[model samples]
Target: MPKSKKRAKAAPASKAAAAQTGLSRRSVLGGGAIGSALVLGGGFWGISSFRTYAAEHDLSRVGDGTLAVVQIHDPQCPTCTALQKQTRRALRALDGCGLTYLVADIKTPEGAAFARRFNAPHVTLLLFDGQGGLHRRVQGLQQAAALEEVFSAHKAALT
Candidate 1:
């Protein structure tokens, strides 16, 4: 009878090592891919929502005027926050303007109809020159100087 060759025994796997490798593989190939897809999906949705907001509004109410200001804003929008901050500073510099700021929530469909009349975007800043006239409407995120210029453009109506 021919002698059979003995096979080498395999080393036992370490529980910790197996667990770590399993998790790493899942993260790199499985969950990681899903996570990336979710991020891209969210980004696309956000941009589309912004476009819809822009289209739904008329913005006729934001023309040159001398009245309290009304702003249709999306709090989730960073540009809106920045615009609001800058407009507030400008308003403070000009006294007796009697600008009453009415911040309207219009980031969603329910508020879209009301916001449409204002013709403002998802993020916007508007100033009413205390004379029942709209002086300026600013859209998007802008630097302090640019924002100041927008306020300055309506300097005649500041008082």
Candidate 2:
């Protein structure tokens, strides 16, 4: 005589656009998470691909019959940046000195190998003679005057 409980009416989905389109709440959340992961991953990849530290280095020419000064660099280190500023000032002061200024950015494989090969750490400077032989290794943050003196002495030794 009475209607059965199993024959109850269904919930309303006839008016909602998402319900009409057959999209579920779980699916929507999943899609949003995937999209966010992809965007963040791409952004991280882009940042690393075009890193700014020593971006213009050419390690191949380091030993090409020229006296050289190489800085073991790390882009994310504050002390390394300070050392870089000091090195730059010294180089500018010693302009026309035939000493090739180079950077071995540890972020790159070649640069990392170079640093390892010489046992050099970040914020260190390597002085190379005309034949690319290691002459001196100076470590830590240095004043422009001190760097200039070192550069000048090394340059004089080569000449």
Candidate 3:
């Protein structure tokens, strides 16, 4: 009786199969760790860049005897558009209040940095007093009545 040669051929085939798979335990783990490190590093770099940009730009526009309504938003955002409409309605209602409205596009690097510096969320509304002090901060979508109330409360400073 002849012993089968199949078992002898199987050993080399198994080694070839392992080579085709190409990845070892160490390589996969190491690659994953390196990839994660790169992602984290990139995130930190982005944050640093935003901070630097914010520091370079002058965000304080309201000066003595002037009132400012700063709206930080993304033009493409539906919520921001809605907020703009609501803000316009509010401003119309308070026609006599000598307030200035400034729209900052968050898509720009400067805008992004400004929002971060002020800790404002997307579609944020910031009210500044004549002295350039932040009087109120509103985050997210706001109703016309709510915005009007804020303006009304700051009317004395605005005029």
Root-mean-square deviation per candidate: 11.5, 9.1, 13.0
Q: Write the per-residue lDDT of candidate 1 for residues 103-137, one digit (tens) a residue.
A: 65676564566467657666666666644455567
Candidate 1, residue 7: how far the Cα is off, in Å: 76
Q: Ranking under lDDT, best-scoring first?
A: 2, 3, 1
Q: Which candidate is the best by lDDT?
A: 2
Which is better, 2 or 3, measured by lDDT?
Answer: 2
Q: Which residue runs does candidate 1 get wrong by more than 4 Å?
A: 1-66, 107-111, 129-135, 155-159
Q: Report the candidate with higher TM-score, 1 versus 2.
A: 2
Best by TM-score: 2
Write down the lDDT that model 3 would get: 0.80
Off by over 4 Å in 3: 1-60, 157-159
lDDT of 3 by residue, 48-89 (tens): 988764542345555545788878888899999899889989
Q: Which whole-number lDDT from 0 to 100 does residue 71 have in model 2?
A: 91
TM-score of each: 0.44, 0.65, 0.58
Q: TM-score: which is higher, 1 or 3?
A: 3
- Candidate 3 backbone collisions, by pair: none
lDDT of 2 by residue, 2-25 (tens): 354333322343326567787788
